[model samples]
Target: MILATCVAPLAAFACRFNVRDVGFVDLGSDPYRLYLYVGDSMPMAERESLQSISTATFYDSNVKPQLLPLAQARQSEARAFIPEDFTGGVPAAVLVSPDRKTTLSLPLAKSGVSVLQTAWEALEPIVDSPRRNAILEQVFDSYGVVMIVEGKDVAANTKVRSMVDAAVSETTSKLPGLEKEIQQPPVVAVISTEEMEAERAFLWSLGIREVKEAPRVAILYARGRMIGPVLDGERLNRESISAILDTIGLNCECGLDRKWMQGVMVPLKWDRDRKQQVAKQLGFNPESPEIRIEMSQILAKSGAGQGIHRSKIIGDTLDELLTGYRTKGLAPENPPKQNKKPFAESLEMNKPEASELMLSWVVVAGILILIAGGAIVLFARRRES
Candidate 1:
């Protein structure tokens, strides 16, 4: 009991689930969502389409409608309106509204990932596809501050909105020509301070001097560190905001400020199934030689590109591959015993039944011999007397 009490502090640090955090992303059953099934295997054209669509989901948060992998959609218990045949082929899309009153099954575009945007746009006129606000909470903090301005004053609001817009444009203007080189825009939100009473401490923590009383712009960056000028409402202008935006073009908001409440909010940041299945499809056999060579070729073909994401994904696949190896067919888990022995010795090592029977026979033979010897001894004694 004493030892357990002493070690109790260590228990709090242990992670019990795979998810880091789950942020609120309008998971209401009523919103329209597109369920896309891009299974393990895809032809060259289909694979290109899937990759493009998947990439779009990461970059543009405004691409209306949630993009849940069809496999995950069916498994997600939260979704009560899944159709019976959602388990079909690759490169398929099902668009459905919250009410289930209107549903449409659309053919995927073989042209490329453009299919994702096109598919959503088609549903815009017909259904009310609810979109979550594109405020990436503190995502680009390391790169630079994303000034979230909140106030009722028209002058303050106009000044901050102009500064925010100019900053985004100015920063994006200098990015490299390639799409992959560019990043998603950093988050900048303008809202009423009175409406954000619950976030007073959060605003204050961002270095805002007079949060509720005056026009304040909270600049969050350096992973939650506050910038003094913006919060104090002194340097709320184009030059200052652009200066900050220039440092980091855009940031990945995939896992940014995502939080969860236990098992209810498991992460979809990393797909556990697709990663393993895709690696298998790529013919990733860890047991084979020339692994590095094979991996390079596979990654090039995959079009996932070289980055932390590529490394992480391939690593996950290899881990699953090794796990598959360990659990494969009838391979002896333990080596055979070294010592050779006769059948009798082997039997003795086994259950006691055979040994017990042998002992019984020996005991009966000894009893008979003793009885005969006694009879002969008695006869001799009588004759001698």
Candidate 2:
């Protein structure tokens, strides 16, 4: 029994294949699998090809070269492969193994097309020939395959449909070579919509209009005059409202308001402490008219109505107090410090320079000279004898 167990272990080891043992074939000329290596300094064609894919596509660093060996070992693995062609000016490298495993590495190239093309070329030999029937059969065993699409704006572009279709056609066409190994076409997964919009907005804000689709999220607010839902003239759901607030570093709480039944109006400013206080004071409906009159009276008595208009004083003080309460719950326990500098100190700081004082005296002397000359001329005329 022990010898049998040892033999079984040996058999499993023999069946396993290393990625290095696989061979790569250049099918770059193939119309369906046209491959290109895009680098930071690659050609334009490769970049364009990559752009043809969806704007939502993104590269997965963890799975890039790791999946190449599996692709070469079985034809079914082709379903997991994606074709990328680089057209940028950046340089890149494509490596493949004899067992059909392929590795496409882009050191500095950001183009997704270059990476895909490199991978396609590396596995072209096994995918194109009939001698690799066993591998193809294995690829066909599954109903759906995983394909990676990489690009910066991959999620926003509508062109991804064509790229996906092309990849599916090319991969499925070779299924006949390994009929028993192949199962189904591959499924394409792109970047999430939220991520796409975020990227778009960021790029646009930075003056990058050429960027991909802009993400959009619905915004909704409570139904009231103070706060309601409206985004570019559209209404939003409760969930959307919450999401919008969250994005802008705000929050909302839902509850009944006895003071102002007009449906909880979110103050212009968010005040957690004030909100709680108001919530507790249910049924205590403070009249707006009364509040206004009280505020007017306070202003009239304070003698702060000289150059500072009465209305301005009332508005500023009320707003300050109300906003403070809403945002930070009541005033501080300790009063604020008043400016108490002595008049002498103030005069010393405000004293004019000697040059400025001399200039002022000269202007005064010129005005006096003109006045005296006019008086003298009038007296002479009167004594014209």
Candidate 3:
């Protein structure tokens, strides 16, 4: 009892559900599908160039690259999405969205090695600015990020900007009471209208192609997964912003659907070094397949009402990942354990047999009758005397 009381407060501060871990596992669920077209008669140089994209650092692990022979490409379901007149020949490529709704094509490597280089650029366009760099750094170090994409109206943008500051302040005040200890408060970033063009690819990934009428807010956490829908108009209020931030600070096993907690990730390369730094902060490698698998399973079983021991599963996986957990920062402080049995199971285990209950009742009745008969005999003796 004493140990539990001492640890409970400390556990309240350490967030069990990390956004970075959630984002890393989310990538497993949704990866860009890159299909490379090839032919038996293709030149060795072109074939090699197309194959190199799979190992490219910028390609990121989130892209699943597949080599498809030209003959098989025609028979594939993807053939319908390809244009009839696309005579780009061998060494061509098609990039499909995770949902298979969007497709981008890279024409044949016509202009020697340079054309292939262009194809790589088109496949994964790197978009960054000074503001984006700060945002990325903050997300790595802090709990999450709240980004404001400014609109054309200066007055409206100014008004919405205050909303972020107020929301963040309120969220910070409530952090101590949260189930999870937040590493840091969410920081705010702004993308001016002028800089939006340079960050078109980044914005597009967040489903913001252009910000025209009013400024919008996007809440991103752990490798840049948007927490929920973009807030604008009347939805962009202090209370709404605080509510979402509060949501992220809770225990992930709280039964919220993964879909509600996760959205599209901003197109950014989460390389190994950055992942390592995040791992140190989180105390476990989110890059590990074992951890990712467990996280995916948790999200899959979310809201199922199954007697799934979620925290125990994740804690065991983390323990295996790092030995001497306390010294290495691999262990969650006082990880939640499902030690108590379910109500039905407890009743079944402790319930007495019906026969035993009846026998005990009969024995008690006989004792009471014997006492009553003895008392009556004593009363008759006194009367006779």
Best by lDDT: 3
> lDDT per prediction?
0.39, 0.29, 0.64
How does each model score on TM-score? 0.28, 0.16, 0.64
How well is each residue in 1-385 modelled by candidate 2, as lDDT tens digits? 4335433532331211110001000111111111223334434564555544311121210012222222232344433333354333443333322223433332423356545455444333212323122222222232222222123455423444454445445444544432122234333333344333323322221122232243222111121111112211122222222222221111000111111112121111113443344323322212235433432332234312211011111122323323333342221122335547898897887686675577667656666776689899999999996
Candidate 3, residues 231-325, lDDT tens digits: the string is: 78777777667656655665555444566456566656677787788788877788787777767765666331111112222221212212222
* Best-to-worst ranking by lDDT: 3, 1, 2
In candidate 3, position 269 carries an lDDT of 69
Evaluated at residue 184, the lDDT of candidate 3 is 85
Please estimate how well model 3 matches the true structure, expressed as its whole-model Cα lDDT: 0.64
Candidate 1 on 1-385: residue-level lDDT in tens?
A: 4445434544432222111111111222133345555543445565565556544543322123444455565677424545555554534655544344444555554465555456534333222211101222333212333555566667767766766777666555545421123234445656465545433323322333244434555444322223224433555555545533432221111111111111111111213443354335323432234543432233233212121111112122223323322332111112236658888787677554554467656656666777789899999999999
lDDT of 2: 0.29
Worst 10 residues of 1 by lDDT: 254-263
The TM-score of predicted model 1 comes to 0.28
Q: What's the residue-level lDDT of 329 in candidate 1?
A: 14
